[model samples]
Structure formats: structure tokens, C-alpha cells
Target: GGSPALGTRLKYQRARWERKRSRTAKELLETEYKYLEQLDLVLTYFVTILKAKGTLKPAVLETIFGPLESLYSASHVLSLHLEKGNLGAGLENFCQSLDLYGHYAENLEHFFCSLKGISLFCCTQEQVRKNKSFRRFKKLQETRPQFQGRVLEDLLCLPLQRLHQENSLQLLRVQKLLKGQKTQVLTPGRWYIREGWLLVVPSKGEELKRRMFFLFSDILIAAKPCHPLHPLNSNKLSCQAVYPLQQCSVDKVFGHTWSQGGLLSVSLPTLMQVLFLSWHGVSCTHWSYRLLVTSLSSGKEAPLGL
Candidate 1:
């Protein structure tokens, strides 16, 4: 037959067919890979949500994670706002402190070791090196977390502090309002408010519990009604009467609010959430609603279209 050269036609035809098949296969693999990747991420997030379901709110996942799998998602807008907050100096200072600590281990380490009663006489260097528990304890004590100049404290104040002194609201009342959602507490509790003070007592504990009661009562009379108080007074003995708790030991509350001014452990997550709420308002768009009002028009987003 005089149709074509057998070798040349067959080679060209095979090459073209191979190219088409390769292209199709590549596209199919890419699509399948993307679908599989998405499925994997979804599965991981579902697992996290299941583990945390008892703790985290399900509805907030949408606003934070973009309609699905909101695990570990924090708000970008809120982050930007916090970056622009008055915490600039505090953060810078905190960084400086960390740098100093990193650069010099002798002084800080020596002090903490002394605090822990390392007893240089009793322990040989080799023994200290082999002691895993000692090493872990030392590591934890050194890194037990401190914050910038009350970065969180200032954040908690950011929302209400903007109000004039005359109209300034009580922090407890506002906090109560914000946290009014219903939930069961396995540890049962009781709180009573009297004359601008809130008293809380745990169910267990009887003898020293009376001490807690007496302590709070004294604090109330001293606070003069519009003061912020820390949960525990570190010093209960002899503190200069700073406020209500002033009469108590200054050390008892020295590291706490009221008498004040000592390094204290702050809850990082709660601090972050509070900062977000303050910067964004009760919900995320509250700031935008406040900003986008026209002078000529009433500047409110129309009431919920319910």
C-alpha cells in the first residue's frame, strides 16, 4: 500500500497520542491531589473540633476560620488593631527584657537557683547534670511566663477607659453583662454583690473560707466603690493601706491589684480574647459601624433586617 512510510507515521501518531494522554493524566492527578488535600485538612479540623467541642463555641468557628475548620484561627483584623495599640512600649520593653535574659544567664539563673535551694555544698556538678527533675523544674521556673507592661491590663481597659470619668462603668458589671451565657458548672458556686463589691466563695473549704470572707469585706470598704481588684491578695500581712485590701498584708496582695505592683501570671488566651473584644467592640464589625457613618445621614447600619 502507498498510504505513508510505516515508521514515520507510526512514530508521529504515537508521539501525539502520548502527549494527549500525559496531559489528561497530569490534570486528573492535580485535581485529585487538591481534593485529597482539602479532605485531609477537613478531617484534621473535625478531629480538633471534636476534642474541643465541650469547650469552644461552634458558631464562632465560622467568623474566625471562614465558614469551616476554625481550629487555631485568630482574627487578622484584630491582630492588626492590637499591633497598633498603646502596647507598643510594653512590647518593646518585653523584647528588651527577653534579649537581656537570653544574653546573660549568670545573674538570673543564680538567683532562681538560690530560690530553689540548690545548696551548692550538697550537690556536685555531676549530680546536678544527671537530675532530670531538677532540670525540668529549673526550666519551668525560669520560663514561667511574664507579660509586657500590663499589655493585657491596658487592653482590658481600652474599651471602657475611652468613656468620660463621670460615665465610667464598673468593670464587674460590664464583664457580667458580656458573659451572661448559660452554662453548667460542675463545681457549683455562689457570688453575692453588696455595695459595689462582689464576693465569691468555693463550696468546699470551711475554716479558712471564713478568712476569705473577712478579707473581701475589708477590701470592699477600702476600695471606695470604683476600684479594680485582683482575685488574690499575695500579701495579707502588712501593706501600706493602698486601698481596701491595704489594711491586709501588702505582700498578700502586693503581686495583685489594689495594693499592687508585683510580677503575676496572666492568662494569655483570655487576655487575647479580651483585647479582640475591646478593639473590635462586642462583635467584629462594631468598629466599622462606628466609623462609616455619614455626617449628612444618620450613620448607623440599618437595624438587623429581621
Candidate 2:
């Protein structure tokens, strides 16, 4: 009787594990589909339309888009495989096509420079700005309903950001498969929510530092980029600080002092620390608002100053 009961318990645990695996796979596939759609939007609306209208020359267009066509094709192929319920095949296809992503990453800075009229291509910055056809094309993109308020910079960051998210999800899966083996510092219920680059103002009269922040369910982690001089650790992040949401408060800084971008002051009263963060061409207020909401939901009684 004892052996049979133990066997049944083991079977039940296996079934639960299978269910979790299925759910995770489904989530991965759905996210891939959504990402593919976004890529298509960029290709169809920006690339194809610009080419058809002859708004920019081929070289200029290449400078602006830079491997976007290949990225869209790869994403489409992966999405098709995922749609057929073959997550392994889809991931394998993506892995084989990673060189395309690498190429894009290498050229990302050039793409941004061209977009911002920093004169990376054959045309000068003045030529780009004064080009009537390019201005019309940019205006059209701004009016596209599909973009939902996102600019070209936001769209361009999607691939790398998605890569980070995939890594986080894969790590989570590994943790679950190990049955909480304590492999890493990941807590049981904590999960990744969002992550991005932010300029952190450490203090008055101090230089603004670039930092990569990962927002978890209950904490915000600030990490500094490894120095380029150390090639081995160049791609890694060194965690500088972790702010627990339960003891944090976020407030927007008012006035015209920060004219270039929006500012958010994150106060950690318990730790006696304050962090002022800003993002270029992105809504710092929106992120601060979300942080405040997360803090409130974490059972904190602090009121957010708008």
C-alpha cells in the first residue's frame, strides 16, 4: 500500500511539471508571435513604404534600417515553427540565425546615428534634415496607429530587449526543472518584470552614469556595465545596488531644470539613499509611475509624488 501511494504521488508531480512546461512554452510562442508582428510593422510601414515612395536612396535606407529585413525574415520563420507547436525547432532555427542579430547589434549605433541625422552615411546632417521627402516619411511614421506612441528608437531596441527577456525566461525554466536546487540567487516567487538602460545621477555635481536596470516583481537592481578594457567581462553586468520595493518611494522631479529629459527621484528611506534617473527620448515619468504602483502593491504605504 505504501509503495503504490508513493508511486501515485510521483506521477502527480510529473504531471504538474509537464503542465508548467506546456504553459511556459505557450507563453514563449505567444511572445514570439507578438514580436514578429512588430517586426512586420517596421518592414511594411517604414521600409517598404519608404522604398516605394523613393523618399531615401538605397544607401541611406540601408543605413537607417541595417539588417532589419533579415531580422524580420528570421522572426517570421521562427514564428511559423512556433505556430506548428514545435518550440524546439523554432528555438533551433533562431539559434542558427543568431549571426543576423549579431550583425544588427554591431550596426545598431550606425542606424541610430543615421536616424538622428548625425551624418553617418553619404548625406550630411543638414541634407537629411532639409530633405522634404524624408521629412514627409518621418511625419507619416509618427501618425501610424500601429506604433501606439513608440518612436523608431523604441522599435529599434526591441530585438536586444527581447533577447534579454528570453534569457531570463530560460533561466526561470532551468530553475523550475532543477526543482529549486538553489543554483542562483533567484527567489522562488520573484520574477523579471522589465529592464532597460537609464542614466543615473548619483549626486549633485556628479557626472551622470549609464546603468542597466532590471526591474523584478519586488526589487529594482542597478547594474553597471563592465569596462571595455576587460574583454572577457565586457558583456557582463556588475550589480551595484538592489532596492527593495517594500521600502522604496518614487517621485517625479518637477520644474524645467531637466529640460533634456524627464527625471524621477527614487527614495529609499530605510537605506538613506536617493537615485535620480533619466532616459533619453523615453518617458521617465511613465516608468517612475509604474515603479510607484509596484511599490504600492508590495504593501508599502508611501504616496507617490507626481
Q: Distance (Å) between predicted and true CA of 177, model 2?
A: 2.2
Residue-wise lDDT of candidate 2 within 1-306, one digit each (tens)? 347766565456445545665676678888988887887778888899888988777877776677888877877786777666665556645655656766666667654555554443333345667787787777679678888877666677788677666657855663344312423436644544445668887667777887766665577877665443444543345677778888888877766244456667888877755665666534464466557767776652211111
Instruction: Report the C-alpha lDDT of model 1 over 181-217, residue by residue, as the tens digit.
Output: 2311111111111121122223355321111111111
Which stretch of 10 consecutive residues in model 2 shows the poorest summed lDDT?
297-306
TM-score of each: 0.16, 0.52
lDDT of 1: 0.26
TM-score of 2: 0.52
lDDT of 1 at 256: 31
- Worst lDDT run of 10 residues, candidate 1, spans 184-193
Residue 34 error, candidate 2, Å: 2.1
lDDT, candidate 1, residue 107?
Answer: 26
